[model samples]
Target: MVRKPLPDYYAALEIREEADEVTIKKAYRRLVLQWHPDRNPADRETAEEKIRLLNIAYETVTNPIKRETYDLQRAASSRKSKAKPRSAPRVEVPKEFMMTPLGYPECFVRSLGRRVVVHSRSDDPESNFQSFFASTKLALWWLPEVNNMCRIRKLGSKARGDKRGAAAGRAGGLNMAFDPQKAKTAGAEGSEVRMAPANKGQKADSVNFVTKASPTCEGALRFESASQRGQYLAFFPPSHLRVVPFLEEAEDRVLDFLFVDFASMFKFITLEEVLQPIFSAEEAGVWIELAKLQDDEAVKSHFKEVMGKDVWDVEDFQAYFEGHWATFEYNAEEKKARMRPKQERLAKQLRATPKAEEVVAAVAKTDESELQRLPVGALARALTALAKASSTDGEAGEATSAQIQLLAALRAVGKGEEEKCDIPAFELLHSAEKVLDLGGDNPDDTVLVQRSAAARILANKALKSASAIEGGMVEAGFTLPDVVRFLLLPGAAGRDLLLATSCVKLFEGRSIPEQREVLRTAKSRGSTNTAAAAGTALLKSLGGGGPGDHVAAPDAHVEMVAEVAECGVRLPAATALLRRMAATANPLKLAEALLALASRVGPGQAEDMTHIAESLASKGAFGNFPIKTILETVLASSKDDTLAALVVPAVPGHVYFALLVL
Candidate 1:
C-alpha cells in the first residue's frame, strides 16, 4: 500500500509559498507559454512533464478545501514518526485505510486494542469527527462529537461486563482537544463555515459494544482522540464516498483498494484539467486578450466588470500582469535622468541656434549620427539657419543643392506637408545651381539641365518666403545677369541661349537704371558682340518666342531695344513685337509686318521697326534668319504680283543668289 508521498504542489509551480492567486495564475501562464510543446520542441517530453506537474499543482493547491486537507495529513504524518520511536508488532492490516509515512504501519498489533495513538505536531488540533467508510461488516466505529471524545468498547458477551469501570480507566486521561475547524473559522475572516454531519451514527448501535479496550480486542491497544474533522474518514470524505471499490493486491497481499470517486486524486488529472482556470475560466481568456489591447479605456472597462473591485483596479491589475511596477517605474526614471542633459542641450540649441550652421554642415556632409543627435526642434532651427544662409548668399555664395534640398525637407516637416510639394524657393534655385555645377562631372548633361530648369519654378515659388525673411530683397542665387555673363564669357557667346533665357525671372524688379547698367556692362565686356547679342535676345524675347516658357521681364527691359535703336518715340509695341519676329517669328508673319510697317513709316518719326532688319544684317546675325523671308513676306501681301519681276532685275547677283539658295 506504500505509494510516493503526495506531490509537492508548491515546488511544482516554482513559486513562493506566499504567492497570491494573481501571482500563481501569472506564473502558470508564463510557464505554460515557455514550456508548451509547440514552443519547446527540443525538450518537448520534459516540457510536457513539467506542464503536467504544474497543472496538478495549480489545481490541487489553489483549491482551499483540498489544500487544507493536504496540509493536515502532511503535518500529522510528521508528528507520528517523531512521537513513536519503538517498532510495532507484526500484524496484518487492511490497506484500504491510509498507510503511515514509513511503510506498512511499521508492524501492526491486531489483538487487544483497536485504537491508534495519535501524535500531533504542536498542540494537537482536533475536531468533531466524521467517518465515511463502510466495510464488508459494519465495522465497530467511534467518532468524536462536540462535547465528548469517542472511545471503542468491546461488543462480544465475555468482554461486555468490563464496560464502564475499565473504559473510564483506559480513557488515557487526555484533555478535550481544540477543534481545528473552529480555530480556522475563527481566524478566517468572512470564510463560510462548512459543517456536514458524519454519514453513519453509532448511538443507534448502543446494543452492539459495551466493554473497555482489552488485550484481546482486534483493532488496537489504545484509543486516541480524532485530531482533525475531515481526516476522520478512513478512505474519503462522506460526500465523495462510493460503495464501489476497485480491489487489488500486491505479491505481499496487503489489502488494497482505491476510492475511485474522489475527483481530486492526482491520478485522475490531465494537463488540460490543471491548466484550466479555477474561477471565471472564460474571464481568464478575456484577461489575456485585454492585455493585448493598446487602448487603455477599453482594457480598463473590461477589467472593471470582469475582475471585481474586491480583487484589483484596472491599473493595479494591469501593472501586476505586465510585471512589477516598481521595476518599470525605476527604469523609466533612470531613462529620463539619463536623457536630461541631452534634452537640456537640445533645448538650449533650439532657444538660440547659435551654431546652427554646424548642423547644416553636418547635414551637407551626410553625417547621419550627428543628424540623428539633432532633435526635431534643433533640426528645424538649423535648417532655418541654413536657409537663411542660402538666402543671405543669394548671388554671392549660393548654398549647394544638397543643403537646399535638406532645408526644403525640414521646411516640409515644419509645414506638415512632407507628402506634398510645398518646396522652398531657395532650394529650387540651389538645386538648379548644383545641376549647372554638375557640368564638370557630366559634360553636357541634358536631363540634369532639364531638371535644373524644372527646379527653377520651385526656386521662384520658394522666394517669397525667403525674401520676406531676408528683408524682401532679391536673394535669387542664379541671376539673369549671371546667365548674361555666362554667355559673355569667352567662347560662351550665343551658347545655351535657351539656358540664358531660362533665367529671365531673375531680373524681376530691377530698375531701368539697373537694366541700363546690365546692357552697358554687356557691351563693355563683349563689345558690339554682347550688345548685338543682347539686342537679338531682347528682340526674340518681346512676344516672339513661346511666351509661356519665359517669365515676364521688367517693363524697363523692353525699352532697352528702343533705347539702343535710338528710335525716338519708337515703334509701337506691335512693331517692336514684329521686330523680335526676325529672331523667332514666322517668316511670312515677319514679312507681313515689314510690309505693314513700310507702308506706315517715312523713315524717322519714331524710328519704328523701319530698319531693324538691315540693322541686324549689318552685324551678320542672320545665320539662321533669312533676309529673303522678309522680302517674300512683303511681296506676298502685295496685290501687284508683277512687282516681283521689276524688283528681281534690280537685286544684286549675290543677294539674288542668296535668296535662291535659301
Candidate 2:
C-alpha cells in the first residue's frame, strides 16, 4: 500500500508554485542562511521542520516525473477544496508584431468569439477610439507586455489585484496608468465584456514616438484561431515619424508593400542603430511626401536625393529595409528561407549524439524537434521536463497544447532518421521471461510491454530497443507491435527462435519477399555474434545434428558465418564467437557460410576471400573437419571454372588457398 502523503513543501518554502527554478533556488539558499541549524539557536525545532520541508519540495518539483505526479495530485486536491468555475480559452500573445504607422493594434474577442483587430494612438483623442469601436459594446482589456512573458490572469482585475502598473509597458519607462476605481466588466466563456467610454487620467500624458525599442519583438503567437481578432483603422505608434504629418494609410502602403508574414519567427531590432544620422526627423517627413506623391518621376528623384542611394529593384530596397527592420514569413506559401536537414546527414549521425545540456536547452527554447540528435533516455527526460514545467498537475491547459505541438514537431524531426538504434538485448531477452513481474499474468503478454519500456529509457548502440535488436525495425519510430509467432522459434538456437518466430508473425500481412528482407535485417544484422553462437547451439541441444532439425525455411543461413569472416572478426569478442561456432561444429552452417563468402569472390575478387581465409586460419577455426565434405559442397555450388577459381586465387604461376583450407 502507498504511504500517507507528506506535508506540502511549497507552503514551507513560502513561494508561489509558479516561481522560476532559479527563484526557487534563490529562496532555498535564503532559508539556509536564515534557518539552518547552525544559524537558528532560538527556534531549532521550527527551523528543522522548515528546512526539511524546503529540501523535499526542491527535490520533488525539480524532478520531471515527480513534478508531473505531484502536480496531478495537488491540482486534484486544490480543485476539490476550491469551488471555482473553469476559465474560457483566450487568444495567444503575438510573437512579434510590427506597429503600423498609426499604432500597436489591440486584438479583442467579440461576443460570438470572432476577433476584432484594431489599433489606437495614445495622442489620438477619445473620439477616434470611440469612432473605431463605433456601436460595438466592447472593452479594451489592456495588458502590460513584458519581454516575451505571457501570463494570462483569471477572474482578477489587473488594477485591483496587480499593484504594479505601466498601463501598457512602454519604452523609456512611459506607460498609461490604470484607474481601479473605474468600471470593470469580465465574463466566462461565451460571455461578452461590455465596453465603456475612455475615462480621464487613463490616457498617456503626451505622444512622442522617437523610441529605442525594437519595432518588432517576438511573443507566443499561436498558429491556430485567435479569440482576440479585430479590425484595424489607420493608426501608428507615435515615433520619430510622428512629425512627418502624412496620412497614415498613404505611408504604410509604401513601407509594408512587399511585406511577408513569417509567423512566430520575426524578432525586433531597434531602428536607432540604422537611422541615427542617415534620416533625421525632418528627412522622414520628406520621405513620406515622396511615398505619397504617386508620380514615378518625382518620387524616384526625391527618394534618390534624400536617401543618397539610387533605387535598383524590390530586392535591393528589401535588403535596405532588412538592415533597419525585422524579418517575417509571407502569408502566401512561398519558398522558406530556413535550412532543412541534408539527406546525407544521417550517415554521419548514426553514431553521433548531442550533449545532455544541448538537448535540455533545445527543450527550453521550445525547439524540441531538434531532440532527434539526443539519446532516447535524454529525449524522454527533457521532453517530459519541458511539458511538466509549462503545465500544472491537473486538467489540460494552454501548456498541454504546447506540449502536444512540441511532440508533433519532434516526431517530424525523428522521421527517417531513426532505426539506427543498434542496441543488443539477446542476453536480456533470454532473461526477460524470468525478471518480468507478471503479477500472476502471462509472461508472453507482459514481455513486449516490459521490453518496450526498457528500450524507451535505454541508451547505447546494440542496446537501443529489444524489438530493434531482434527485428532490425529500429527505424520504426515510436510504434511497437509485438506479436509472438512461437514461444520458441522452430530452427533458431537459444531464445533467438523466440525472436525469429515472433518476427515472422510481426508482419504477418506482408508479402514473403518483404518479410524475408525484414527478418534478415532484424536477426542477422541486429544481433551480436554472441547471440549468433547461442542460436547455433540450440539445434544440437535439441538433439537434432542435421538439416532436418528445423525445416529448411530457406537453404541459406544468410551466412551468419560470413558475418564472422569479414571486418568485425578481428576483435577479441569476434575471436570468441569464432571459437564457439567451431566448437558447436554445425556443418550445414559451415557449408552455407563458405558458399556465401564464395558468392562474394570471383577471380578478381580474391582480396576479401584471402582476408577471411587468414582470419579463419589464425583462429584455428577449422580443426579435424572432413575436407571432402567441404570440397564436395564447394564443388557442387561451383559449376563454372571462373567460380571455382574464386576459392584459391592464382598468384604468378601458383594457386594457394592462403593456408586456411589447405
Highest lDDT: which candidate? 1
- Predicted candidate 2 versus true structure: per-residue lDDT over 500-574, tens digit per residue: 433432342333333333334334544433233333332222222443312232223324434433323222332
Question: Please, what are the lDDT tens digits per residue for candidate 1 over residues 74-155?
Answer: 4433332112111234233232232222112211111113222222111111211111111110112333342223432221
lDDT of 1: 0.35
What's model 2's TM-score?
Answer: 0.22
List ranges where model 1 is wrong by over 4 Å: 1-461, 466-649, 657-662
Check candidate 1 and list the clashing pairs.
112-215, 113-220, 113-221, 114-219, 114-220, 425-462
Residues forming the 10-long window of minimal summed lDDT in candidate 1: 128-137
lDDT of each: 0.35, 0.31
